[model samples]
Target: MNEIIPRYIYGFLNSGLLLIKYCRSCTVCSRLTRFPRYNDPKKLVETREGRCGEWANCFTLYCRAFGYESRLVAPYGVLTLILDFTDHVWTECYSQFLGRWMHLDPCEAIYDRPLLYEKGWNKKLNYAIAIAKDGVYDVTKRYTRKWHEVLSRRTMVTEPSLSSILTNITNETRRGFAPQLLSIIEARDIEENQQIERSLHSEDDESLSLPGRRSGNEQWRKSRSEIGSDNLSSSACPVRLCVDEHVTKIYNAFRPVLHQFIAEEVTKAEAVE
Candidate 1:
């Protein structure tokens, strides 16, 4: 078992208090500007809202910043129950100890909800569960023509790049660390360290800028090359229109189970400590 997985889970679970405080107190907005069209990597970070509302992004970033392998999961839009909408994102961690994947609902934790199982889950949901249990779930019933379409939509869309993922992680970590570091410096009357901290933060801000970052561009180009020429035109793809439908199905199918798993894990961790 790789030592990092447990450490990430521990770090994530333990950082709940700090995460909440930062989310509440920070003035930064969380809206993504390059939404609706998930393909343009350039527009990804141009959000007016701070990072607080985007807890999944923050959590994924945190895990990656700590060197834990993580990925974002979303539902296919087809299975929403009445009055339920289905655009959501979550994080999954690759656990070496369990030799599988583990789902981490950072957004849910911030919002104070347990993970649950939704009916008619999509590939992401199934992937998340498989990680959680360290085994595959019965995805047979869930697979359908519509579900395949959902998978196709994801494949067609631009998947997040390693650089973007890392940048997000870096932003979240700096955000998480800044206030605490400031508080510590304030406590110790460490005047000299303040200057050093400012310089470090300035560097971080420049590095995180998406425009000049070669790594982000490289990743975007790499993804484009992998997708080949088929279905490059978003307008030609019916999968985009059907995405919401598939997402609804996934949410309805697995919400309950996910909620329970999160609750139990939190409880066990608390008891152990």
Candidate 2:
């Protein structure tokens, strides 16, 4: 399922099930562009608004609908491939077969392509932290090539303080959960943190990746050689027809089946889980 997921999810996001609409700027305002905000996942699942943050959150929820463990990531850093960092959101899902978290973007329909932002789009990422009902985890290496370059800027909070806050948040959020669920979450947080530690220690470059993931640098190099431009960028997503029109078709075609599935079994599945 992990190996073949790109076939289904790639088509789902890229084929237009979830659309992408640029915010005038982003979460933070620029001299030229205004700060952009987005709809919540539940609302976007129905509305299909297509903003980046909305796409990330809704996709995380969608993965959960399929019983995949997932998280919402907020990466605050440079997308300019330079010093100015901005606020952006994406998703990461645990791959049982791969034994690590893989990056996913419903906006670009990219999976495990952390370097796509930096190498493919020429961005410079400083910090990427994932937030969930379980806990928070630093997932910067999955998206950055220059940890040393950005370490000084990552001083927003100390690791100890951040960890404490995440644990408290998870506990507060899990108020109604049974002991079993709390235990499961605690184990999950530990596992995810271990992965983060490994990432921090890894000497791999953008051309290299974790055991179960593909190389974004390799993919970008291939795309450049084949297409002559970086198509992964939202502004330049390589697809036929206008992206909005293309996705509208996918949404119309898939929505009925999805709604039917939810009506029939999603509730039961959630209860069982």
| Per-candidate TM-score against the hidden true structure | 0.26, 0.63
Model 2 ranges off by over 4 Å: 1-38, 77-85, 205-237, 240-250, 257-273
Q: What digit string (tens of lDDT, one per residue) describes model 2 on residues 1-273?
A: 001111111113422342222223322442232222234454465766443566677778767766788888877542221233234578889899997788886565567876666555545566777877566666776666566776767787886886687667766788888899888777866786787667667665645422211222344335433222433345454332355466578768866756666567566375336
- Which numbered prediction scores highest in TM-score against the true structure? 2
**lDDT, residue 107, model 1:** 29
Off by over 4 Å in 1: 1-53, 78-85, 110-115, 119-273
- Which pairs of residues have clashing backbones in candidate 2? 16-247, 77-85, 77-86, 78-85
Cα lDDT listed for each candidate: 0.34, 0.58
Model 2 Cα displacement at 227 (Å)? 14
Whole-structure CA lDDT of model 2: 0.58
